[model samples]
Target: MKDGRHLVWILDDEWNSHELEKSMYNQHGFEVKVTRSDKLEDDMPLYAPCADGVVAQVGFQCRADVIDKLQSCKVISVSGAGYNHVDIEAATQKGIMVSNVPDYCAEEVSNHTLALILTVTRRLASYNRKVREGKWDPLDTMPIHRLSENTVGLLGFGRIARMVAAKLKPFGVRILVHDDFVTEETFNVHGVEPVSLNDLLQQSNILSLHVPLTTETNNLINYERLKMMPRGAFVINTCRGGVINEADLETAIKEGHISGAGLDVLEIEPPSPDHPLLKMDEVFITPHSSYLSEESIDELRTRTTQAVIDGVHGKHLPYALNQVKTETKI
Candidate 1:
């Protein structure tokens, strides 16, 4: 380490709680430097060459070009569960371990998913807008069904999806899950039914996505899959945006094939005002804020900093997403 301390660089655009992360890293004899993601390239030549580790958020893209520029970085720590923004293959090839704070926002995201389901199913947005605009007709939101009468399908039964299932169990809703990695026992223990992807898409009245973004999962919910869903089915995605084809979703909603959608993330963030989905009253969108809670943010920051500390100290990272040869010793 230079000057008896490890230097870690943080690339983020929205976070302002660096004091919390800085204090924790300082305790371990690490010096932290924070920079905005937009200015990372210019700042990299000045800071990255000497960085012992790097921390980044979803807004930052650490591709092969950026990865190739780091001269001494040993680990790339992501502040959230999804690390598709980081180039794992390039990091591994460069002997740089990549880690992520996966379990930090499980509760927050699952709660957000439930909120979206309730809003879309009850037509809460439509009712609220109509009531404010002097249209007080209960029939405006007709055909509202009880939660128990509908089936909810989960695309992937991971930590967050399991929490969603647990929260929804008391409502007596039939939950069907399709996850290749999970066994029938996993679903049985949660009081959920295990089903194939085709069955899940064909039978569910509400389909929620909770899978990571990968080659297999990218555009998993496409035109054909949307066609498989029963008419009037609602789609909710709190996971990565690329999992669902945005154009296909817009087409389905426009054609009245799919009833509505609740999306926390979109294929293109902060979509243009002219976007058709934004104009639809049947669609509800959040600005990728499903993983935010006071407690969760603190946990995410601490766990991410801890990963960098572990890497600098030559210790095993608890949430390492990639295996790399330990050649850079602090």
Candidate 2:
């Protein structure tokens, strides 16, 4: 602690200002240090040994080497839903709680997923480009199917995926979901049919992925899976990009098996200019901003700060992703 106040390190440098973080932590009788580093892992040595709590941004690596160096850190709170960046196993063994704010951006990401779904389903981009080029015919983008006739399938029935289902209910589309963790009653309550992964792929006219990236899910949507979908099927991914093999996806789209795609995240952020997907007019890529909105940003900051505050105060960390045998607390 610094000056008898708990010291929290904000290991995030992407944000424009730390005023919100400072004000929140300060009001709770905590001292906040803002660390800026292009390589947080390389600079972890300077902050880990003294930080009472650490707030790490999404995509920041908190590997075992860095996590083992944390001397006083009670908790490492990830500011986003995905905690794959952190070494949860190492933190657990070190008695440091690992938490994430999964629900903070549920509305924003679900809305973004819906937006991508509509963008590809309606062929909006194709028409806009045609209209801009002085073409007036709607037939410029042919083979557009009615949304009501499309069967939308969700790979995971998490908070965001459920919200996506709620939003799509009015559209008269049949929604199928596949999640091993979800119970049958939950699927019934949501009016969605739970199917095997194979059935989901074979039947969905529009497949939207929401599962986190893991060894089991990496490249889950490859060329073989793409072939299972009906011809001209559109793929949407607002979650982890590694879930789909970029190379296989390009090949499927090139072979005209998969129609088009709306991708908010890619296997690599700011993919190199020569990335094959960059040249595909059938693909729409966003800079992984699915969880962005002023409201969501404020909520994210508030919840992330709360986790640190709880940890520093010796309270159980909220939204904890892992269990620890002991937590270093005041």
Best by lDDT: 1
Over 151-199, each residue of candidate 1 has an lDDT whose tens digit, in order, gives 9999999999999999998988999999999988888888889999999
Give lDDT for model 2. Answer: 0.89
Clashing pairs in 1: none
lDDT of 1: 0.89
Lowest-sum lDDT 10-residue window in model 2: 321-330
Per-candidate TM-score against the hidden true structure: 0.96, 0.96
As a TM-score, model 2 comes out at: 0.96
The regions of model 2 sitting more than 4 angstroms off are 39-43, 327-330
In the order shown, the candidates' Cα RMSDs to the true structure are: 1.3, 1.5
Clashes, model 2: 0
Which runs of model 1 end up more than 4 angstroms from their true locations?
Answer: 1-4, 328-330
User: Positional deviation of 152 in candidate 2, in angstroms?
Assistant: 0.9
